[model samples]
Target: MDLATDLELDHLVGRARRLVVPGRRRILGIVGPPGAGKSTLAGALVARLDGEAVLVPMDGFHLAGAELRRLGRAERKGAPDTFDAAGYAALLGRLRSPEPGTVVYAPDFDRSLEEAVAGSIAIDPSVPLVVTEGNYLLHDEGAWQQVRDLLDEVWYLHIDDDERVARLIERHVRHGKARPHAERWVRESDEVNARLVATTRRRADLVITGALTG
Candidate 1:
């Protein structure tokens, strides 16, 4: 890890350690625009926590590609309406209340297939924290509001516009979109969603501006 990432991990670990109780689960939500490194930060934090935390990403709640196509939303797949916001909120609620010896399974997003795989993540009841990273955790409208309510704390990752856009384009290309198509998707679809997410930044408990260099 780079110095910046080390510092960030230290800060997050300090804050998260305080939330730990002997028998209760603490939920941490990391929210940011596409390509802002929410998942990178969350993964680092969870690894540092050393098995005490489990990751349950909100990407798992994305509507299936088939479903998106059926609803005529495939072109704008990352929009707020393309997710099962209510189901995501409900899962957060479940993660917050764990029964002894019961393992909770959460869906996982498979980027290669562009689909959500059910029961892909297992959260054992012994885990004390759940680190969930996503683009819309702080979105206020509809069932998304409940998602904000279910978390113990929410951190918003912020990145420079140029860097974020570049990362988004690269990510799209890596995920099978050609260079020209990736550029268009970032400019047309991703930027629109990014602007919407920016509007909700004020609601975050912390604004994280660290870049993931490692």
Candidate 2:
């Protein structure tokens, strides 16, 4: 779907609703660059759905802050390799073929603490749908492709470039970065990653745009 003028986000969310089999779970993934409003959309969809749904963010797979610092990748924390991509893929594979009476625990990222906390969440097979969101979910190369295959369907959220950059800068400031530093980071680092993600847009099963209320 061409998010710009084709199908609306609500339509996609409704489709996801149908994938929920009463006894089994479905995994739906949302992929987009920073400030694309993916988190907001995911939250809204989960809220709209009447059944059980969980948001298992891929951010949870991020390497610990200390580990990133140790590897000299602290400055590029959101880059693909900074996360435990392979481990996340494994989790999704397990989620796909869950065992009876077994519960799966997953890690979650703590923004305030800037670290990944293990066993932060439990996924019960009865939940029906697990909605995971991240920047690299649709990426074609490396273990990212495994992520795409694992998801029953993938949605790419698209937003205007100007608005996206503005939102990213605001996010940095809200997270304690100085204005100039935030702008520089958005231009130099975030935008670079955004371009890489743009190339993967074609991989999405659907695309969403505008605000959640729009």
Candidate 3:
């Protein structure tokens, strides 16, 4: 499972706990390339935080499949331009400081349907932490540039290219793509985005290694 060491996991848990203030909300952004396990790590962190935290993934902001086809961007579905980057940033801003007694709903990406389901995650006002994981949180261009400033801290996940690539291909296959097609998508689409994500690594508050499977 490539589980993180006890000390590493403990430190992450501790850092997440410290982010929780009694009366204020904090957002933690986890960034990684395709198949680097951003969602898995974010889910683990939120689970450890008990009921004090909730996960609102950035994948929720992916442009609808039909919209992508209309824009002639279906072939580049995982690329930066295929997402509603501005809307994601705006959502984060709202989640960062929501109005009192307000309940905010966040979108969720459905892998099987390959669509974003709106209002899937509800963040109550009493929750003190929001864990958002995605590929572009550290990106410095276009609408994504505003994401960093909105996050309390952003952690970058690093994995060997071969491992990450394998994971991407497998995920695609599991989601109903043919094996050969999955390989092509990983090579042509995912790897291109992975290189872009790598460039933003230095901007992260921390770099996590060898925790991709956990």
Each prediction's TM-score versus the true structure: 0.94, 0.92, 0.95
- Quote the positional error of residue 71 for candidate 1 in Å: 0.7
lDDT of 2 by residue, 1-214 (tens): 5444333557766787987787887899988898898888887777777657888899899998889999998888888888888999999998888888889999988877878899998988778899899999988777877888889888888888999899999998988899999999998888988988888888888777665553
Q: Could you arrange the candidates by lDDT from highest to lowest?
A: 3, 1, 2
Pairs that collide, model 3: none
- For candidate 3, write residues 58-97 as lDDT tens digits: 9999999999999999999989999999999999999988
lDDT of 3 at 92: 93
- Write the residue-wise lDDT of candidate 1 on 94-198 in tens digits: 889998988999999998998999999999999999999999998999888888889998888888899999999999899999999999999999999999999
Worst 10 residues of 1 by lDDT: 1-10
Cα lDDT, model 2, residue 80? 89
lDDT of 1 at 197: 98
Tell me the TM-score of model 1.
0.94
lDDT (C-alpha, whole model) for all candidates:
0.88, 0.84, 0.90
TM-score of 3: 0.95
TM-score of 2: 0.92
